[model samples]
Target: MSKPGKLIQELNRMVNEQFATPEFHHFLTLPLNRDRARFFVTQSAHYIKNRRDSWGYVQGAAPLDVKAIIWKHEEDELVNDPRCNSDHYTLTVKTGESLGLKREEIDGSEPFPAGRAAFYAWLHLAKDRPWLEAFAASAILERRNNGKIVRGGSLSDRIGKKWVAELGFKWDEMPDMKIHRDADEAHSDLMEMIFNRHVKSASDEDAALRGARESLEIDRAFRGALADAMEKIS
Candidate 1:
């Protein structure tokens, strides 16, 4: 029976390994030509929308205090933020415009099969698992995006930099990713607080780790599917 702090540290290390997975690296480093960029940005919108669905399940299953925390988190994601002036989905479409994508194109885009499977997996955990396990599963995604947790930088921060350096887009032009770079740090901390308060037993810790690890595996598959899609774009 490890302490909660040690349990969280182990979870963090496990989730960080997702970034080092070959599939994740392959997707992140994929060349961002116009076609690929359009595909990426469009699929990103699908991913963001899936987050809304999955989080709704988590919010429903969570304890009242944790639900309150998630509600505030959703205020920024589902509603307007001071930094973005719109919800995250709209912000993603706005970012796509900088890549020469129209609102219609992004709105009409469908998620690849692997991405859909990943979303369903997340929703299953959020809706069917115990509250702590479900919450940890959902929160681990944001935690993995916390550059402070990950050694180099978060997924959003790293990808945002790549867009700036390789795709010739300015940071300001990609408001969604830019905001996530900062926002997920706080989001991750909030989740940790939940874990500290709730995860008291060895079984609870094991459940949390199981949910987080499974989600990361789905994440890798989703990223790999995206990379394969990008390669096929002509």
Candidate 2:
């Protein structure tokens, strides 16, 4: 098998393994109330903003063709997507509406200290690391969200199911997550395209693995911190 194919299999394994971590396990198992749900969606809007910043930095450091691909990916994120006619951040705010969150509430949401630190860690990878590593750091997050890749379901699917079971929300009322569950399937294909085209040497594979590993670690810490904060809410 080719190096990129092997690398992709390893990355997929890494993503699935995350659900078993203490952080992911705790976060996913948390029982949801309306207040906790409100807090989660509000905080998630900040995460969406961080993704925009990191992807812009990654775009600036990438090769022209890669930059073009990132730009096209950002179109659905930064501008209007025909799928929802809302940029991703706005879509997140809209998601909050289902939890009784007003626009100002989401707009004023702040990240926990650990979550803020994790966002900065991702920024460093995107802005200062090698372009492929930076690309992998961002792409791996989408790969984690891609339902086709993650067995059972992606993060959004799991959380959305919680809303239905615990908070009485129907799947259709949570369009933002449903949209991402589909969108990431396509976005993750873009990640594989980059790897197949660029990951030719052992060092290239190392860079991708490094990014994927570190990003997932930071993601664990971030999710753990959010769970801690949510626990304090009720």
Candidate 3:
């Protein structure tokens, strides 16, 4: 049974390791034409919405203090983020618009079958698991996006670079990606605080690790599925 600090290190290591997995490698390495890029952006809006839904469930299941923190986190994602002067979802739509996607196109898009399954899986974790586990499940995603933790510039940073190099868009043009690159870092720090406070025993660490592991597996499948779908587009 590892100490909580050691467990946190292990979890951060696990997230960094995900970038080396076949699913992430394949998804990130795939070529991006305008059509493929547009497809990805549209699909990403669905992913963003799923985050909102999953977080709502987590908030409901968490302790009151944790719930308050989660609510504050939601303000940036669901209500209004002062940094972008828009909610995260609206920022996603604007990002798609930069890629020539219509608002209706993004709004009407559905997650791929695997993405749908992943969303439901996360919802289950957030809604049905113990509060610590549920909170870890949702927090792990933000941890994966935290550049300080992920070491390889985080998911959005890597993907945004692809857009700049492959699609010829400047960094400033992708407001959502830019904002999340910073936002998730702060969010993950908040999550870490919770683990520091609550993950006292091996049992606590185990539950949180279970949730994080399952969430990452689902994330890998969802990214792979997105790549497979994009490959078929054109």
- For each candidate, the alpha-carbon lDDT, in order, equals 0.86, 0.90, 0.89
Expressed as tens digits, the lDDT of each residue in 74-190 for candidate 2 is: 999989877888788877777788777889978877887888899999999899999999999999999999889899899999998998999889877787887898888888899
How accurate locally is residue 199 in candidate 3, as Cα lDDT from 0 to 100?
85
lDDT of 3 by residue, 1-234 (tens): 437678789889989999999999989999999999888888789888889888999889788989999999999998899888899998888888888888998998887788888889888998899999988889999999999888879999999999999999988778899999999999999877888778888899899999999999989999989989888987
lDDT accuracy of residue 64 in candidate 1:
94
How many residue pairs in model 1 have overlapping backbones? 0
Please name the candidate that would achieve the greatest lDDT relative to the true structure.
2
Off by over 4 Å in 2: none
Candidate 1 lDDT tens digits, 117-177: 8888888888899888888888889999998899889999988888888878898899888
Better of 1 and 2 by TM-score: 2
- Per-residue error (Å), model 2, residue 49: 0.3
Q: Indicate the TM-score of model 1.
A: 0.96
Q: What is the lDDT of residue 196 in candidate 2?
A: 90
